[model samples]
Target: MSRARSDPDRKLRKAKGRTASSARWLERQLNDPYVKQAKADGYRSRAAYKLIELDERFGVLKRASRVVDLGIAPGGWSQVVRKLRPKAAIVGIDLLETEPIEGVTIFQMDFMADEAPAALSQALDGDPDLVLSDMAANTVGHKQTDHLRTMGLVEAAAWFAIETLAPGGAFVAKVLAGGTDADLLGLLKKHFRAVKHAKPPASRKGSSEWYVVAQDFKGRE
Candidate 1:
């Protein structure tokens, strides 16, 4: 395990145009150990550590041969997948443009589009053994609305995984801190042998994000 160095907390001077919120965010980033470790480890964002921790606990990547990455902007999660499973076929989609990563087929489009799932499945050429979603809807500053939108994306991703995953495949997705809603949980329980939720240490203590891991797909019979 990489440890955070004992550096002093960095405080940025209040600039002419920086808002208080932005300044606080900047300071938080400056002081975050995971952020610093991500830079040193050549990962794209601190989020890479969250996936690493989750995988360490769940072994989600160990046996994956083909993978789909949803919400792959900045390409951090896919980068981890590439490094951990060098031979796995990887396909990723995001509304935001992502710089190309070797061994990853990226499509800069909304995952909710009617044709998006087919495109991902076609690119992989077979059912994926692992599906990862780090997607979150753009917050409209309303907590309830934000949660609903994000959960909707999660539900869509779950359906994609259910529809296309190979038997015994795994699905991992980001959810709100209260965890997967009742309907989604019931859906996963119906199709997977195991369903669990985890909040990795790399996630900020103040953040309301959690991850749901569903494995051992029962297949679409």
Candidate 2:
């Protein structure tokens, strides 16, 4: 693990008008060992470790697997997937452009568009072994609004997974932990043998973000 280094400019700025929240955020970022370690490891974001930790626990990555990554901008999670499954076929899409990375094909487009999933499926050429979504809508500051927006994205991603996943495949997606809607959970339980929520250590302590892991996908058209 790398030690955290102080930024003189940041310290000076903090001294000028440090609100409690700002100070806490700065302190957390500076003292976070994972943040330092991620920088040293060349990951695009600390969120990369969240995927790594989840994969370690779940054994999701496999050799030559076909994988789909939704909202993969910044490319941290996609990078981890490529590193773990070097020969796997990966197709990543996001509303924002991501710099190209070897061994993965990235598409820049809004996934909510009518043609996006079809385009993604065409790129894959067959049902995927895994579908991973790290998508979160831009927050509007209202907790209820944010939750609804995020849930919408999750629902859409789940629908796509249902259409494009092979039997016995997996779907992993980010969701808020207030509790998933019973309707959605019931739908997932119907199609997957196991559905559980996970919070990897790399996620910030105060964030509501958690991942839903659905395994043993039943092929349902």
Candidate 3:
């Protein structure tokens, strides 16, 4: 049975200042097929495939005209959207400046800032048909704390999506392994016709991350 997967374990030579954990991570990245494929495909990061897979399954990007990309740093998700829907009017926000991508309006500031949602909406100049947030709080190693913090970001993104999406729009965001908390799930269920969770194949099996897709926005009534 083990012969079904033939790639041998790859180890790295011990190097100064590289911790064992860091070495393992580096080694894994070096050997990962998706990492290599990302480079070959000219993708900024492997996370691009996660969105692609999700869209393939859920039809999220099919007719999106106006889109908002939250936490779009290296711009992988935005890149995918740009490719699949070339005419999409994309506006992305990040605390870190992203290099220019054609036809995308980028805001280099914290999405948690008081002015963020309006800025994104204003830039789009229309309700978004797709709102995407790959935002996750920085981990501090405390499992409960990390989950709570990330959930806070997801909740905020959800509210932003609800407020800014056009009728029949969709919202997709990254959430932790156990999925959206009860209250957040309730909120999504009320606002969208379909609320589903998925862990795309590109997501590391060991990672505690998944995506919550809320589709068919019920309008602002």
Q: By TM-score, who's the top model here?
A: 1
Best-fitting candidate, scored by lDDT: 1
Provide the lDDT at 199 for model 2. Answer: 92
TM-score of candidate 2 to 2 decimals: 0.89
lDDT of 3 by residue, 1-221 (tens): 01122144766788999998999888888777777778777779889999999999999999899999999989999999999999999999998889998899999999999999999999998999999999989989999999999999999999999888899999999999889999999999999999999999889999989999999999998
Please give the ranking of all candidate structures by lDDT, highest first, separated by commas: 1, 3, 2
**TM-score on alpha carbons, each prediction:** 0.98, 0.89, 0.95
In angstroms, what RMSD does candidate 3 have relative to the true structure?
3.0
Question: Please, what are the lDDT tens digits per residue for candidate 1 over residues 140-221?
Answer: 9999999999999999999999999999999999999899999999999999999999999989999999999999999998
Ranking under TM-score, best-scoring first? Answer: 1, 3, 2
Q: Candidate 1: which pairs clash?
A: none
Error of 3 at 143 (Å): 1.0
Error of 3 at 54 (Å): 0.0
> Which residue ranges in model 3 land beyond 4 Å of their true spot?
1-7
Instruction: Please give, for residues 28-93, the per-residue lDDT of candidate 2 as tens digits.
Output: 776677777778888887788888888888877753389999999899988898888887889999
> What TM-score does structure 3 among the candidates reach?
0.95
